[model samples]
Target: MATQSPFPFLDDLADRVGEALQPPPWFVHEAQRRIVLLVNHVLMQEPEAQSRLARHKGSVVEAHWRHFQVRVVATPAGLLDLADPAITPDLTLTMVEPSPLALARSALQGEKPQVRIAGDVQFAAEINWLVDHVRWDLEEDLARLMGDAPAHFLAQGARGMADALRRFAGAAPGRPPAPPSGTAR
Candidate 1:
């Protein structure tokens, strides 16, 4: 059975609103810089991901969604840097989805957006490996700012909330699984 939304106009409204709100050049550049920093940070924690990226050294990968685009080059140190806009990218990943509402719903359902991949096959494979293997450890990152116990506490709460949300948006709730081997439930 197909469930319909009461407010179907919201999707169209969101698309129109997004089209109306054009960000300044500075905002786009700043957002891209932040994205590079975050990506590099996650890559640094995974030596294998970095080493794989290092093999591609100067290879540039450009990602596109609608009018926004970002180009990043693999660095010798296994990190990523904003690539020169004039340089042609070795690989390009263009997301096929256009609606923000659909993308958000897909994300909530733990699904990947469809993407059109182009260019260097080896570089693309390396990127695919990184995507499958690398993940940011938010709890560990939080531990750096606060104490371990407090970080764990907050992370646990957040995880539970996320799990509940996932259940609501996705699969039906089943019996709660036992906690990992160690620590009380």
Candidate 2:
């Protein structure tokens, strides 16, 4: 019997990122580090999972482990999940939504994405919210994983995601979307 490949998309992603950014090894390393850090932060904030995934790190385990069930995808829009129709996002955002974060981290950590993991197999329509908001820098390897789009776009998506998180964190107890810096609505 042959061993199964962990990340089947990695080879293709490597090619795409290599062709898109052609970044130095260090930059690629940095991007990977940042991605994992962001993912870790998302995982730590979940309700019942903080104790289980304290030690794992890096994309190898993150990409293959089933804890968070967060599968990184490369589409014309960027990275996102195959599930979650609401976030059918085009540009990749940090996994920051409370519900998705719980599911994603659980999947990545080799656990399960909620009790209905089976439903998560569905993919959603691609949305452009992240592309329209925020800013960021992308490493070549990271770009390739995202199908080799220009790095600036990915960076913007990241920024948008951060903005979304900031808004969520700053929102009133029962209200949605915190008001902007100095405006009362």
Candidate 3:
């Protein structure tokens, strides 16, 4: 029932800053390139995901959020690469939540943000499958660098922190909900 954000001024300032501080075109382009590379690396670890993507080889998927857009095309190798700017995307997904804080709050509470989908339905289905089924094994990746025990310890700490954040965001993990801001006994 509370209609106010915990940090109202910061939230408003962030929204304004986000609107006014759009990154340069080259910076956005380079960020998109790195994102594609990371995505390909994750996809490479899952053969089933790769096979599903490979079935749609050359299909383009473009995602838009605010002023940022990333267009990637499925490659024959079952990986993704940045698509040419001119190639019309076979599928386009636009995130409906405009506020960064709102989106993060939804994510921390284990909810998916709303998306507006357009273009190929089958391609969208494949992408949805990828989202639901594929997960990066963070502990495994960390263990490769720092050995098993430390990696597991770090992962557990992270999970505990995430759970704390989820609780702070109004999730009930067998605990009472946090009191509303500006309220005290």
On TM-score, the candidate that comes out on top is 3
Which runs of model 2 end up more than 4 angstroms from their true locations? 1-20, 54-185
Candidate 2, residue 166: the lDDT equals: 62
TM-score of candidate 1 to 2 decimals: 0.85
In candidate 3, list every pair of residues with a backbone clash: none
CA deviation > 4 Å runs, candidate 3:
1-11, 171-185
lDDT of 3: 0.86
Q: Write the per-residue lDDT of candidate 1 for residues 68-112, one digit (tens) a residue.
A: 799999999999999999999999999887766666656777877
Q: lDDT score of model 2?
A: 0.39
lDDT of 3 at 122: 100
Tens-digit lDDT string for candidate 3 (1-185) = 11244456876898788889989889888898898888887898899999999999999999998767889999998899999989999999999876677678878888877889999999999999999998888899899999999999999999978877876876444668665446694
Q: Which digits, one per residue and each the tens of the lDDT, describe model 2 over residues 1-185? A: 22223344754565565567766766655665577466444434442233222221111111222222233433232222233324433222233322433343344434422221112211211112222222232444467676566665777777677666667654544678766567778
What ranking of all candidate models by lDDT puts the best one first? 3, 1, 2
Question: Which residue pairs in model 1 clash with each other?
Answer: none
Using lDDT, give the best candidate's number. Answer: 3
- lDDT against the true structure, per candidate, is 0.85, 0.39, 0.86
Alpha-carbon TM-score of each model against the true structure: 0.85, 0.24, 0.86
